[model samples]
Target: MSDRAETSERTTMAPRASELGDFLRARRAALRPEDVGLTPYGERRRVPGLRREELCLLAGVSVTHYTRLEQGRGTRVSREVLTAIARALRLDEDEISHLMDLAAPARRPAQPRPEHAGDSARQLINAMAQVPALILDRRNDVLAWNGLGHALLGGHLDPGDPDLPAHRPNLTRMLFLEEHMRDLYGEHWPEEATLAVASLRLTAGRNPDDRRLAELVGRLAVQSGEFAERWARHPVRTCTSGTKRMDHPVVGRLELAFETLQIPKSPGQRLIAYSAAPGSPSERALRDLLPQGRPDAEERPRAVLSAVASRG
Candidate 1:
C-alpha cells in the first residue's frame, strides 16, 4: 500500500461525541453504587449497576448535570467537575485524561506533524545497535529500526513495510491477537497489555483527532474483550523507562531495562532502546543470538534517513 493509504488505515480517527458518550456510559454502568460509597435504593431499577442519580451523588454533582454529560448534552465541563467525575468513577490518571479529552477535543486541524529525526537522531539509534533500538510514530507505528532492533522485536515481520498499516505490527494488537506475541512473551501478556492500553490512553488525550489512533482503539475494543474493558476504564500512562522480562525463542528468558527517548524533532515519535547489564545471562544471550559481524553499514544510513523522514 502507498504510505498515505497505509497510514490512514492504521491510524485512529477522531472520536465522536456519541462514541464518547457510549464509552462513558459503559464504564459508569460497570461500577456499583457501593463502589463509590453510595447507598443502593430502589432495587427494582432497570439498569444493571449504579443509576445516574447514584453516580451524581457519589461524584458530588447534580444528577441532571451528570446525566447531561453522560447523555452527550453537556459541553464545557470544568476541570474540577471532570476530576470529581473521575474520582467517583474510580478512574486512574489515564482514564482521567480520556475523560478530559472527550470533554474538550483538540481544535480541528491538528498541529503540523513534527519533523522526523535529523542526522543526529539517526546516529543515536545506530550508535545503540547493541541496545535494541526502534523509532515509533505518535500512533505507535514502527518508523525505523536497526538490524539488531528488528531481531529483538519483530524480526518475523517485513521491516521494510513497517509503515503500511496492514503490515504494521501494532504492539497492542500483537500482544492480544498474535499467537507469536503470546508465545514470545509467554506470561508477560497482562503487563504488556496494561502498558499498551495506558500508552494509547495517553495518546488519545493528547491527540483525539488522530483518525488512525481512534480506529486502532475501535478495532481493539471490538476484537478483544479484555482490551475493551480496560479501555472503558480510561486508564492513562506514559511508558518512558521500564523493566521487561521476555522469553525470547532464541534468547530464552531475558530481563532487560528499556528507555524511551523522544526524538526532539518528532513531537510524538520516540526512540526506544533495550539493554541488559554487561555479562548478565540476558546480555550474553542477546549477544549470542545477534549476528557477530560488524553491523551492515549500507542499511544503517538508510535507516537513519528513514527515521528523519518519518517526522515529516
Candidate 2:
C-alpha cells in the first residue's frame, strides 16, 4: 500500500457538526445520572447514563433545544448553551475547548500546506547535544530531529526520512502501524497509544478541514482496531509535558521527562525535547545514546535543506 493510504470506504466526509454530535453522545453515554447528583429511581434503566430529558433538566435547557444540539440541527449554537451542556456533562478544560472546536463552523477545504522546521529550529535541536529533540508539525510529522533524537525514538527508520515530506515519519503512524514503536513502549503501550489518539482528536477538532489529517485519522481507524475503538470513545485532551517509559534496544529501560516548546511563528509546530533526571540510570542511558561530540551546523543532515525547500 502507498504511504498516503486511501481513507476507508466506511469513513464518511461528514460535517464538523456531526463530530460535535458524536462527541456529545459519547460523553453523555459515559456520564451516569448519579455523577451529577440526580437520583435514579429503583428501576432498570432502558439506556446507559442519563437520558436526554434528565440531561436537559440539569443543563437548564428545554429537551427540544438539547435534542436539536445533539442531532446537529441548524439551530444557532450559542456559547452559553454549550457551556451549560459542558457543565452538565462535567467536561474538563481540554474537553471544553474540544467541544467548542467541534461546534465551530467548518472552513472551506484547502490543500495541505507544506510544513517544515526552520533553520533556527534545526539549529536549536542540534545544539542540544545531551537532550534528544525533534521538531514536529501539528500533524505529528517529524520535520527534523537531532542525531540523539533520531537514535532514541526511531533508530529503526531511515535517518534522512524526516527531511522529505513524502517519506517523513509521523509519530502517530509509528505508534499504531509500526511494531518497533509498540515494543519501545512495552507495558506502557496502552497509555502511550491513548494519549496519542487523544492529542490527535484535539488537533482534528481545531483543523476540521485538514485533508491530510483526515486521511491520517481514517487510515489509522481502518487499519488498527485498537485505534478505532479508542477513537469511538471521543477522547480529547491537551498534553504539553509528560513522562515516557521506554525499553530501548540499545540503551535498555529508560524513563525520560519530556517538554514541548511551541514555535510562535509556526502555529502548530513544536519542538519536543527529552531529558533524564540528574544522576539517574536514565541519564546515563541517555548519555550513552548521544554522539561523541556536539554536532556543528555543518554536520547537520542535508535532508534539512530539502525540508526547508519544501516549505516554500
Candidate 3:
C-alpha cells in the first residue's frame, strides 16, 4: 500500500511520441526498394533507405499524410491507415500489432487495479512445487514465486514476499545489468536476453497505456547497452516453451525445459514451470533437495490485476 502511494504520485505518464516515430521510420527504412518491387533510382539518395514518397506510394497513403505520421505530427490515424502502412512495409503479425499499439490513442484515465491471482492460481503454483514455478506480470515483476522457484532462478530474493518489485529484480534487468546473473547463467545470457526483450515487446504491444511498464523498459535501455542494441534490432519472439540452461550454485549445472502457462482469465499473468528430464542428474538433484516428496509452498499477496477486458 505504501508503494502504491509512491507509484500513484507518478502515474499517467505518456509514452514518447518521438520514440514511436523513430521506431516506425527505422522499420520502414529497413525495407529495400527491390524487396518491395520498386526500381532503384539512378542516383544515390541522401537518406539511408526508402524515401517518404516511395513508402507512401507502396502503402497507398498520401505523401503529406505519411510524412506527417512519420514526423509525429499526425495523432488521429485510423486502423485502415495503419494496416495499409504495415502491409506496405511487409510487417508480420507481431510487427503489425506493435504498429497498431504505436498508433493507438492515449488512454483516458486510471482504472482500478485488477486481481493479481486467485485461489486457482495459488493451487496451480502449489501443485508445481517440485518444479520451479513463478508467476509474473506483463512487466516481468515477481508477483508470486514458490520456494523452488526462487532457489532455482534467483536465490537473492525471498519467495514469501509479493512486493519484491520495490527492489526491482526484473528478469530483464538482472540478465543485463546484474553481475550475479551473468555469473549464474554465463553462456546462456544471449538466449535469456532474446527472450526477455521479446516478451517485453509483446507486452508493449498489448498494454501501451501501462506507464510503469514503459518506465521499467526506459530504465533498462538507459542502464544496459546490450539491451538497447537488441531492442534496436527489432527482434520479436514468443515464449511459450523452451529449454533453459542454468548453473545453480546449489545444484550445479541444470538443463531444464520450461513451459509457460497462461493463467485462466488472467490476461497478462503467466505461470512458468521448469522441469528437468526424469533420472537426469538435474532431476535427481532436485528430488534429493526436496524433502520426502514434499514441495515447498510460500504464500504472499497477489499482484493488482487491472480490470481491462481480456485481449488474449
TM-score each candidate: 0.78, 0.93, 0.80
Q: Model 3 reaches what TM-score against the true structure?
A: 0.80
> Which predicted model would earn the best TM-score?
2
Question: For each candidate, what is the lDDT?
Answer: 0.71, 0.85, 0.70
Which of candidates 2 and 3 reaches a greater lDDT? 2
Candidate rank order under lDDT: 2, 1, 3
Per-residue lDDT of candidate 1, residues 1-312 (tens digit)? 543443333334423454456557867888887777777775587886777777777778988877777776776678898888888878766677677777784466455333333456667776776778877888777766666777777878765545444465567777777878778777887878888887887787677666566777767776776776666555568789989888887778989899998776767788888999988999998886675674573365466456746965
Residue 115 of model 3 has an lDDT of 33
Name the candidate, 1 or 2, with the larger lDDT value: 2
Ranking by TM-score: 2, 3, 1
Q: What lDDT tens digits, residue by residue, belong to model 2 across residues 166-186?
A: 889999999999999999999
- Our tally of clashes for model 1 stands at 15
